[model samples]
Target: MNQPLHLMTPEVRANPYPLYAELRRRPVCQVEPGGMWAVSRYDDVVTVLKDARRFSSAGLGQSFRPPWLEHNPTADSLVMKDPPDHTRLRTMLSRAFSGSALSRWESSIRAIAEELAEATVRRQEVDFVAEFAMPLPARVLNLFYGLEPSMALRLKRWADDLVSIPASQPSPQRMEEIRHSLAEMERCFNALIEARRASPGEDLVSELIRTEALTHEELLGFLFGLVPAGVETTVYLLANTMYVLSEHPREMERVRDNPALIPRLVEEVLRYEPPGQSSLRLTTEDVELSGVTIPRGAIVIALMGAAMRDESRFPQADRFIIDREAQSNLAFGHGPHFCLGAMLARMEARLGLEALFSRIRGFSLQRRDFAWSQSIIARGPLTLPLHLEPSRR
Candidate 1:
């Protein structure tokens, strides 16, 4: 038997594509540490995503509520629910991202993007992640929720610790930090929910409260789940877009010359170096996939990174072709649980890139060596230093 893949290892976290390719050959097999099944092929991954009956989303809750961690709000969030419950939660939250709502926020989003991009380029040489990528989403989220600026850094720390739990083998010190962060998040969000209840405003929290659809616990779960889902994913998306463009100057020039292609570029980046690498699922019953029978109650991970690169689905699957015909990819997931923040993430990327390339002629990586986020579920550089060339026009 082949040695099971240890996904959390530093090397794999940095670049797992080569190993992903090897796994695709087997298509469905067990991975180590937890003996979870990894579904790597495009068809099989989609099969797992679409068939919520046979492959349940409860695996998310299982993954989140480990023995060491306390009961996480995410364990009961919409992402972990099945059928009627998931549908109800999704309905309550859908209005916030509706067309009119996004239209209202578009100008603000662009303004923030332009301001941050201008500041980053003014530096000429900087860690792109810190100066631009991280702040764009963080600021956007803060504004959307009407959160105080004082809470931004604390919220980010809590989110980082929360999302990293499933992926990290935390030391005692790290465990304490994670626990404390969780407690702090619970306290902060509870207060926010109550404040909105007493006197609502035009912000998302107030908007949700006006609906009067979700219970207090449900509201807490939704807000708790939103931080990591909303902020970290977009941070990675923006950073990965820059990393891809920096490495492929021709594509960068193409996009800079024709800004209309920015959306396409973002789409291709989502397929090529997706922020969320996999979706967690549980086998509700014995399920046969790729000729392998997975037992009931098994943890199955749909490898989005591998599926997006599956040769059968995408031509020149490994190449970063920005104009590759706009076929669907599992970067933001699919079916009932498709990322609710898809529009917001795409809008931020499009505007962020427009703000960036409009000011800078081009950019190149200052150093080839960099660290990737330690979380197995997310992918992107922790620090991306770049030498940016200002636009001459």
Candidate 2:
């Protein structure tokens, strides 16, 4: 009985690395009852991602939901298109999300982090996921789009529903829920796009609206995609990092003392436990990977979480070492389809963690009982209870 790591079994959700290790030992071949191949080894996953000519980013259908859904919002997303189309959409959005553009939000991100940390410090114990991890990204994205924080929260909810559609076995009820979410999202973003067009401001939506390359549908798709791509992923990354730090007090102390180590710690956390575990790609032509022949027109699942732990790629890959000399992890992905919100996520984590640890001296989990989110493509606890020891300083 082969237990595929991509499944959402309770045991796999709790700890999937052992399962991934089992899968990594086999040749890169089909694991799904269907023909979807699981590419787990580090080199092979990189190959699938880099060789876009052979493996297309699209055609797997939006969010891996039922391919026949009429209300699929991600079909026109930049991550779901081939070159020329993908390149054009990415280029226009790139100007809007450029490093310089994102850097301007650093102070605002820090402020949000500080505010959230201050709020948490006053509580005896808090659900960190709800209080800090989730809201920071939502609020930051809200600030980016000039939306009120209230609207940002609603957007996060819609994004969560959108992204979760792929991980579950689809049903009519689920499809209806997805349609509802998409309608609300479209309504929200359309109004925002209109507002940005009337008076372009120093915001992401305005920058995107000002771009000549994107159509209205394309713009809506990008905005719709941003919530899941930006908010949900960031929430998990931050929550996972906090969980990791709690497990390693010594590393936390070191990072708190020297801020320089925070960046490396962030990278290590990404490698050790990426929020997004796997991404789907469609094969455009017959390809040979790891001596296994993958036929054309098949779906290939790039197991990024598994690849990060491949022993050949990172010595002691299973262990989480903050100062590992080789820091080439695929947490933010690689090749042309690398994550668009990678920089923004990193900034939030750094600022969020820094503000968190600095304010609360001795941080620890309040309870051992926690519930992990069930999904094939993402991993993290649904709620993390935490307690902050009084400041020593």
Candidate 3:
């Protein structure tokens, strides 16, 4: 009887929790915003992620089109694939970047975060997104893989354009930009693969080069996946965490005093401000979900941003509280396609957050210039230009 508030405008993308609060009044329904359906309730969204048999992610690619969306190809991207294909591809890629094998990275990650923090502590001001957030993980990932610094920066820019939510359906111009970026990325990967073939290092690229299951092309795709996933996801996570810290000076100071809290704080940050959001699925056959009939081949998109804030699951879901035992948020994802770099992302956040608070005597948002990145899928700051009171000690 009512149109979901999120469909009204971009408010859901801007501040989804408020909309989630309203939707909780009547959580599950087939929201008809120009024929495409959205399942808002927490249980409903969770089922979509969990039940691979009834609902298929492969069919979801371009399965539903809202009236507002333009000619964006909804083809099955990496997250949309299924079964042996999904498992195989994921394993090949995971072998290279899976965080468990790389626990040793923490020391290096901590060192890098410390260096960035020390650099900023002396100067007393920094744009956390560009100066700190974007570069920290991007450079670290590339360096770990033995990639050149310059190429890493280039790939990061290309990733921003590719993953950036367009104002409307992407223009032909934007598509061209994406194509060129992809080409350049592939070219760089090609060169790297060639080098790895000659004299392999103990890097992800080298490991992938040696993997029997992965072909050269798949290897490229696997590495290319990291191009956006590594840089963009961490960028959002770090920005959100910093914004959280800046707002909650007490919480910020707690972790500052004890660096050991970094891991706990990082988990809470993931629950509070997950970097990755929204996974899509398609109802393979006519099925019932939360009292709503999802027709055959209907597209379903779970807004993790919305699901994480479901009050039924998370009381006072809107509040950003750290050091609590909140369940793992869908930020990295669920089911078969959960983030391969989950561990690394967590370590980076913890180390970076620790280094930041430890070095800066006082850090708070420079609200006058504070701005948010307006993308369809992510909510993070474009520039967290924090003002420092300067480290007295």
Candidate 4:
């Protein structure tokens, strides 16, 4: 297993489990060419994610943030903060993103899912990524932030760029594109915030506007984090769930028959094939793990996808089984920085799957050949082409 498992490799991108299984033999393997440590096993990944004091999330790409974003209040979001600061930011922002708030949107989310499913079925042959998976989260977020549906497309573009930039070392041209996207996002959010201030709406943005805990600058920066948080990963989650279910006919049939199990199916997909493969963290101080020493200021990557498949934590971890007992999966992350939108992501996915199966019968992949996104940070089919059959009423 001497072959490189660098972030951008095709082998790791296409299917990374075998590589992960090999790397887990050594809980922490130093990835050469870049000198970063890869923590693969479940325990180590948890240790890195949970012990924020030892491993900081702030310095993932020290050179990446452009001046505009560098000064934004959200620049120090929950994702990039450690302990006290992270705790405080999460608490203030959690008010509008609380469980009750998320539950209130369930009916509307289901309706959106139903409408998307109907449209997808009418298309007969469609790319699930573009048609259902992508827009589903965007539209739901639109409703959440009180933005018009027209903003979904531009927001999706901004979010896709935002999520991808930090993970890879982009060329100068790509960096400019990312900066431009960030500027556009900042401008768009600022306008929305001002509108919410003028005439408060029954939405998350308006609610946050009313809060005194976060200043306008901080609120704007947090919104930058929120767009991608609410959109990108969930988009991949929905896409991956559909691909897995369609591949596993028995499981698909079971969920289609018993719609209640749709949530369980979503969980299994998160474990079996997480949307986010890894997250970057910086070592705050020297630390030793599983006999390997990580020097101070070293880059540490927690392989969430690999950890979810750790045999010690998960029985038959490689397989996707919906009925498995409840176990913590790292897909939505762990520790204090656990995803704020996890509840919303789950609702959209569960509802989206239910709507698809209920309205469209004989739904199947149009082709077996598919290309996975070449991003080590996330994993899913880039284009999920499928044929949707009419309902068998």
Candidate 5:
């Protein structure tokens, strides 16, 4: 048998596609350290995501409830539940992310993007991830929940700790940090929930409170999951978009010349270098995929990064093609648990890129080698230094 893929290694975390390609050949193979099964092919990954009965989402709950985190809200959130529980929870929260609801924030989102873009370009050289990518979504989320700007720093730190939990074994200090973040997040959200109960407002938290569909704990769980889901994913998306444009000058010119192409560019970037790398699932029955039999009760990983670049599904899967034929990608996940904030994420990326491109002629990477985020589940530059050129117009 081939050596099991060591997913948590720094090299694999940095650039996993080559290893994913090798695993895709087998389609269903063992991932080491934990001895979990990995599903790498597009069809196989979809099957695992869609067939929630055969592949239970409770595996996600397991990931969220690590030793250090005694009680992570995500462990009880919708993403970790299967129907009819998942269906019911999803129905309750669906309205918050509906088109009409999101439409209300369009102008606000654009304004935030424009303001941040102007501020970023004024510096000429800055860490794009810190100045632009991180704050755009963080601010938008604050607006959504009616949070104070002062709370953003804490939210960012909590989000970082939350997502980093499953990446690797945390050191004692890191473990303590994660525990502290969880406690602080719970305390903060508890206050917000009570405040919303006392006097509801126009924000989503108030709306959710008005519905009375979720219990206090459920509400807290949903908000806890939202910090990382709503903020960090979009942060990675925006940062990845900038990184892609810097590397592909022609694509950057294409976008600069015609801003309408920004949406297409975003889609392509999602497929090319998605913010999320993989999702975890557990098998409820003996499952046979691509001629390999995975026993019941085994942990399965849906390798989205590999599946998005499946040679059969996407031609020239390695290259960054701005105008690739439009098709669904697993960047936002698939099936019943499809990312609830996908619309918001896409909008943030679109407007964020538009705001930046309109003000800057172009941008180039200040350094060729940069650090990637530590999370194995998500992928993006930790700090992207860029030198921006102001538009002549």
Candidate 6:
């Protein structure tokens, strides 16, 4: 029997389409070392995500499982559990993320997008991640907590430290720094929690505190979550989305022509290059598919990007088809724990892309181009350099 693909290898990380194609050859597969099973074909990937029972999110660590802290009560947090725990947390958090929160922030988010776009245009050659991707969601969500501009930027950094821990064989000092940064986030968020108690604002944080259902720890967990989950995932999505669009200018041209197509085009980009390339879900019980028996507690890194490109589901999967119907991809995940911030993330990508293209005109990669931050769990560009259309001299 042939060995399973080593997903974290440099070559695969650079471009895993070929590896994914191989997985499609064997519909059900398992990787050694971590004993992580991967379902790469579109149907299998979707089924694993859809059925929370047999396949489990608990196999994945807690959403609020602090890297530093030992305990995690909020394993009940939406990203980390199954059935009753996952459902309850998702329900409560969904209420916070609903129309009420996003509706109130529409004007502010629009203004933030406009400002960021304006700044990007001023500098024709820009790095989309820092200039546009990171800031759009960072600043808008910062507004939610009534954070000071400087503190907001620091909070953004803290979130980065938590999510963007590099995979280099670095020193122990570096690891300490990461844990310290997470501690700082806790201190800062606790202060904000106190502020909300004093005088609540019309923001998600304040709204969350008002819920009265969550304890102080739960409230703090949500705040930390809003930092990384809110900022990192959306930022990664924007950067990756921009990279995909810039690489396929013809596809982008289509969107520019039909402005309304921007929304659907965003979906296509997400499926094309998801923020999280792959994620883990453990099997709760022995599950059989395609003559492969996946035992209980087996780790499954659902290869979302590959699933997005499955030829069976997507004809001419390799080609950049902007108008492609993005139904089958598990980009936002599936099941009860489907992404809570899907609407907000989609909105940000739409605004970021629309704002950039409307002003910047043509865009192409420049200098070092995009660099993928190597983590088996997440996939995103650390830096994305692009040469933009220069204003008339």
Worst 10 residues of 2 by lDDT: 60-69
TM-score of each: 0.96, 0.94, 0.88, 0.94, 0.97, 0.91
Model 4 earns a TM-score of 0.94
Question: Given candidate 5, what's the lDDT at residue 26?
Answer: 81
Name the better of 4 and 6 by lDDT: 4
Enumerate clash totals for all models, in the order shown. 0, 0, 0, 2, 0, 0
Clash pairs, candidate 1, are none
lDDT of 4 by residue, 233-296 (tens): 8889988988887889888778777889988888899999999888888998899999999999
Report the lDDT tens digits of candidate 3 across residue range 1-393: 685444435555555667656665666555434444566666777777778777676754443223333433323345656777877777667755655667767787788789877787676667778778887888787877787777657767866865653234667786667666666766777898899999999777887777767777666656655666678888888888877777788987778777787787777777767766566666778888677677887766676777788777777877877756657677787777778888888878877877777666667777745555555456677788877665566
Candidate 6 lDDT, 130-151, residue by residue in tens: 8888888889778877888667
Per-candidate RMSD, Å: 1.5, 2.0, 3.5, 2.1, 1.3, 2.6
Higher-lDDT candidate among 2 and 5?
5
The C-alpha lDDT values of all candidates are 0.88, 0.83, 0.70, 0.83, 0.89, 0.74
Best of the candidates, TM-score: 5
lDDT tens per residue, model 5, 167-282: 35888998888888888888888898889889989999999998888988888888888888888889999999889888899889989989999999999999989998888888
Cα-lDDT of candidate 1 = 0.88
Provide the lDDT at 228 for model 5: 87
Off by over 4 Å in 3: 7-10, 30-35, 59-77, 98-100, 165-168
Model 3 clash pairs are none
Off by over 4 Å in 1: none
